[model samples]
Target: MALSSLDEVRERIGKAARLAGRRPDAVTLIAVSKTQPAPRILGLVSAGQRVFGENRVQEAEEKWPAIRERHPDIGLHLVGRLQSNKAEEAVRLFDAIHSVDRESLVTALARAMAKSGRRPDCFLQVNVGDEPQKGGCAVPDLPRLLEQARAADLPVAGLMCLPPADTEPAPFFALLAKLARRHDVAGLSMGMSADYESAVMIGATHVRVGTALFGQRGTEDG
Candidate 1:
């Protein structure tokens, strides 16, 4: 099957889980809705997706409020590089922030979280590939940043990493798993539409899948 709808994606989720020796519900599929129309998001929502992700804070600001008015209880995850200037908006919109990797952003998010009296969940984005273009904290520097976040009461529950595009993502995922364990954190958000099987094999607890579910997002969006 070509997998046109969210239901088909869920079935694929099941198959992927079984292949990984895990329960079908173990992996969370972040229906990436960045650049996708709101009606399409509603369609996926109707198709039984409670979790969705968006890349840019600005785009999310435009789309999420309208959608939330229609579905107030859905979980929204910010899966993009967030700037300190937009921290306030991100705090108000997302249930979780998965791309918090910098000291300034952590401080900003702390302020936002405190202001709302809400402890929003977060992930420490680790730059496992050491790519210059990426926005993640360097892996070697993650421990300090993670400690800083914890000290600031950022409610960090896990680590996230985007592996190099050219390499198999499994090794990087495995490394993040080890780093999380070393840091005593429980969540590892790695993997994507392409290498989720590799992610599962390496103990990824959450995978950010976009194209495999909702199809490829706009180049500028993801």
Candidate 2:
């Protein structure tokens, strides 16, 4: 793993937060550890990165169970599409889930949380760009989704999104912020390595950065 890259990204996050008159410490940096091996993840943990994001429940199940045993303070977030059947496992495994995008998921998660007595923070992903291929709830449906999640007793943390790739992301970020405020939610988990600074500047409470911290995907796995 690139150690200096972590420092550099933190520095960038701080700069962006300051530029936006927001506190640097307020923005959580979730190291996207999907496809990365344990040694690389430990290297980042050694450097004091306590929060990580994973793309799949099965992959994270393989990688994190042992790691969490050693570093219980580490937080794991699910940042990809979640199947309704895996809701219980996801509740048991992740500390926060950034892909609670549908009604079935909300109900499943609520049932799982009730059964397990654990509530991982939930983020309702919004398909801000309305990309049919994306995994988030459609923009017009966000309010209803949020209401369902809350009514189901899920811990609604905030909103998350992946902007239309290759387009400028600030406007989408702003729209998410507006929705969060309108709905009285607080967290905004947007941005990635390419555009995190803009995200922090636009009031992102969390940024999922992978490439800048871990280097290209699967390159350092060996």
Candidate 3:
């Protein structure tokens, strides 16, 4: 079931990429495995799924070590809000940090990277929708945050965003792409299970999909 789902999602990504005159390989699909068990992740690994996203640092720390030991080639992304205190652990575990949205986090991550001598690609998440409860930095504050990240010598890969739910996502995706271009960044981490195709059409380099690939959450442990 997972294999077929993976194949279908890949095919959809390819089609979306082609429609946008972009290569399918240009868009990476991150299988979000927040509540997923290690065995199910291994199943996807066996099926050639290499990139995975986890929402929490502690959950990832608990689940990924052994899986990574067996498959060192797999890339892990931290796709949730990262606390300043967890900076060192997040740096040690994730290959990419997609929620670098604050100045303090930038400072902590920079220090952690310096101490660990391992710098993961970082994305500055923007609250494109201006929501009061989201994890991204506000749009007006992005420039300052970007500067801070650069000054700290952090590898700011690109921009990430989650549009307001139930509304059209294209406008938000376009905004993020524009922000990336304005900031001279390269990667755009937008889109998820329901609207990844729209995201790819607009200019998303990375799409995080879980339910589509692994089934609905809580139904399967993996």
Best by lDDT: 3
Instruction: Give the per-residue lDDT of model 1 (tens digit) for 22-42.
Output: 887778878778888988889
Lowest summed-lDDT stretch of 10 residues in model 2? 213-222
TM-score of 3: 0.96
Q: What are the runs in model 2 whose C-alpha is more than 4 Å off?
A: 1-3, 218-222
Ranking by lDDT: 3, 2, 1
Worst 10-residue lDDT window for candidate 1 reads 213-222
lDDT of 2 by residue, 186-210 (tens): 9999989889999999999999999
lDDT of each: 0.83, 0.92, 0.93
Total colliding residue pairs, candidate 3 = 1
Q: Give the runs in model 3 whose Cα sits over 4 Å from its true position.
A: 1-3, 218-222
TM-score to true structure, per model: 0.93, 0.96, 0.96
Q: Would you give me the overall lDDT of model 1?
A: 0.83
